[model samples]
Target: MTYLYPQIIFSKLFGACLLASLMLLAPLTAQAEYGDVVLNNRAEQSGMRPVIFPHWFHRIRFKCKVCHTEVGFEMRAGANDILMADIIDGKLCGKCHNNKIAWGPQNCHLCHSGLPGLKTGIRGGDSTGGPGKW
Candidate 1:
């Protein structure tokens, strides 16, 4: 019974440590700091979460012109009508996500990871798909 005190202290310390860790990491887990652009034009209708586009992530890898100029994505948030078929046909995202440059659309959850509440909220786009109304 003498060792009981030490066990209690250990348990309290462990719990406190875990709580602190969660407090620090909760926001991070909620969403990455990519300044997401939630495109839910047809996602909700199709029974899926909006496409949280990691704008900052790609901006670091490629130049703006690569997508805006070459890919034809407008500067506006909900500008282009990005569809899954267009991607599969090697047009928009399919150009890179074709398994050669990046992983293909086999994994849906990667992009369809529910609307990330960043500074940019769930501002949806057009019916074809962009960033307009949800």
Candidate 2:
């Protein structure tokens, strides 16, 4: 009976330790899996949800220089203060997101996809900055 008690206690402790480790790892995993940049500098005031820019999706078709260099986009978040007026003027994302090249900026909800149940379709948990596995 005494041996059984110690075994039971040890098993419970091991289970608790495993649970704690998993909980701590969850956030890191989520962050890596979804390397989405939430562009919300002017979204709320403009009466829209934040734009969730999924880097993985873009990287699949375009090189880094295409947008960061050719498009004059800053390498940091919120650095490009993009506005609807600028977009209509054929600037920033309008360079490609236009109806002729990609989807037009008129489809506002497509980029401003930060609603309550927005899903970015990103997967995996390795974020070493290499070609991210989706």
Candidate 3:
């Protein structure tokens, strides 16, 4: 009976450990969506530049419909028909960046600036001079 008691306890402990291991492994299989929206259709047509917009960080603060519906952004990138001139005239980004809601067009480095260290695969963060400081 003494030997049987030890074996039973060992089996219970092993089962518990196995369950915990499986639970920890489950999250590894979960899908993580990292934003990658391309901008600049003219660039694609002219073969000059390809703007990659990261939506994950923006989505954290703002809603999708704010830009999609209110700001007149289309579901897909390059479909919004956004122009730098329009923004300068208080259009899409200008709507919020008009010095009233968000940082105005005077701060051109905010959006016009692309993510640096692309070779290192480093995206948005405070370390990269992004809005992550706030």
Candidate 4:
């Protein structure tokens, strides 16, 4: 019985250590690379608004094909050639922002506010700014 007690305690300690090691490794392994899209100078000078599209944020709402295929958006930024008129004509963002699905383009400021929020340094977690401890 005395010998069995030591074995039991050793097994329990080993299991606890294993569990703790797994917990510590899980976060490091689970970290995902959220790619970024740059709003180019062309987009900035478009006179409409500078739109910085975050792949991470949109990934939560819709699939990649929704914009990439259905909307004919190129993988490269500023390649889509998105224009306000096209949106008004039910193209690009207007495809989803029909008011039935998402917010329509009737409210111009929703997207064209030109105020930097998530993409700019004004809001935190923006990679454009210096990388800090997330």
Candidate 5:
């Protein structure tokens, strides 16, 4: 039993080391898989979490034109310079996010989903589908 004790201790220590290595690398893997969008342009500056746009969810419902063309949303993140006033005045997201169509802008967290309290695993699609295309 004395000889077995040393082997058991070594095995336990090796398992712990392996676990620590995996833990350190876990975040990097997640970032690669979820490198969808992290719109932090004005979010952190304005003392808010960056908007994590979920292109996957939106594309599933509305065609790209509904936003990129009609709504005039830029393909890149933070390019629009969206402001709270614009939304309230029915300019940017307010166009559709109004209570009648979708959730109202009053629901701040809906669009300002960059809030730290939330976990945004949302991903977006590339420029594949467009008007008269798909």
Candidate 6:
């Protein structure tokens, strides 16, 4: 007969519970459409409305690695130095928004529709103090 230690059994149970919790929370995180990121680095300076990039909307079509790795967008909010000239020259946003893969910058209001001086960062917040609000 073989005997298992109590600590070993506890660890195995803990690991299983953690994995299950993550699986259950995955869908909730995906439902957060309000997690928009405000890119006001140059919008206000350039006389345009700030860009309200919905992180959730983009996540549905592409994975994080697509933009954060292959497309070269910094993972941190407001970290990438995205410029209109660079984008128009086929860099940063222009990688896909070049009127081919996706809509081009011609429709400025489509992206640059955030309020003035909105600052660069996430828009959603845990106002209710609930778990996983944002």
TM-score of each: 0.60, 0.65, 0.49, 0.52, 0.58, 0.68
Error of 4 at 14 (Å): 54
By descending lDDT, how would the candidates be arranged? 6, 2, 1, 5, 4, 3
lDDT of each: 0.69, 0.74, 0.59, 0.62, 0.65, 0.80
Stretches of candidate 5 exceeding 4 Å from the true structure? 1-28, 31-35, 115-134
Candidate 2 per-residue lDDT, tens place, 1-134, comes to: 34568789999999989877866675475643355776777877778877888888889989999999999998866677889888888899899888998899889899987864433343345554333322
Better of 3 and 4 by lDDT: 4
**In each prediction, how many residue pairs overlap at the backbone (N, C-alpha, C within less than 3 A)?**
6, 0, 0, 0, 0, 0
Candidate 5's residue-wise lDDT over 1-134, tens digit each?
35568789999999989877865654444532233555665666777766776666677789989999998888755567777788788987888888878888777665566646543233333322222112
Candidate 6, residue 117: how far the Cα is off, in Å = 2.3
* Best of the two (1, 4) by lDDT: 1
Model 1 TM-score relative to the real fold: 0.60
**Which TM-score value belongs to model 3?**
0.49
lDDT comparison, 3 vs 6, better candidate? 6
**Which segments of candidate 4 are over 4 A away from where they belong?**
1-47, 113-134
Q: How close to the true structure is residue 130 of candidate 1, measured as C-alpha lDDT?
A: 19
Clashing pairs in 3: none
Clashes by residue pair, model 1: 78-131, 124-131, 124-132, 124-133, 125-131, 125-132
Cα RMSD for predicted model 3: 12.6
- Highest lDDT: give the candidate number: 6
- RMSD values for the candidates in order, in angstroms, are 14.3, 8.5, 12.6, 13.3, 11.9, 9.7
Encode model 4's per-residue lDDT on 30-55: one tens digit a residue.
32234544443444565555554557
Task: For candidate 1, write residues 86-105 as lDDT tens digits.
Answer: 88899988888888887888
For TM-score, candidate 5 versus 6, the one ahead is 6
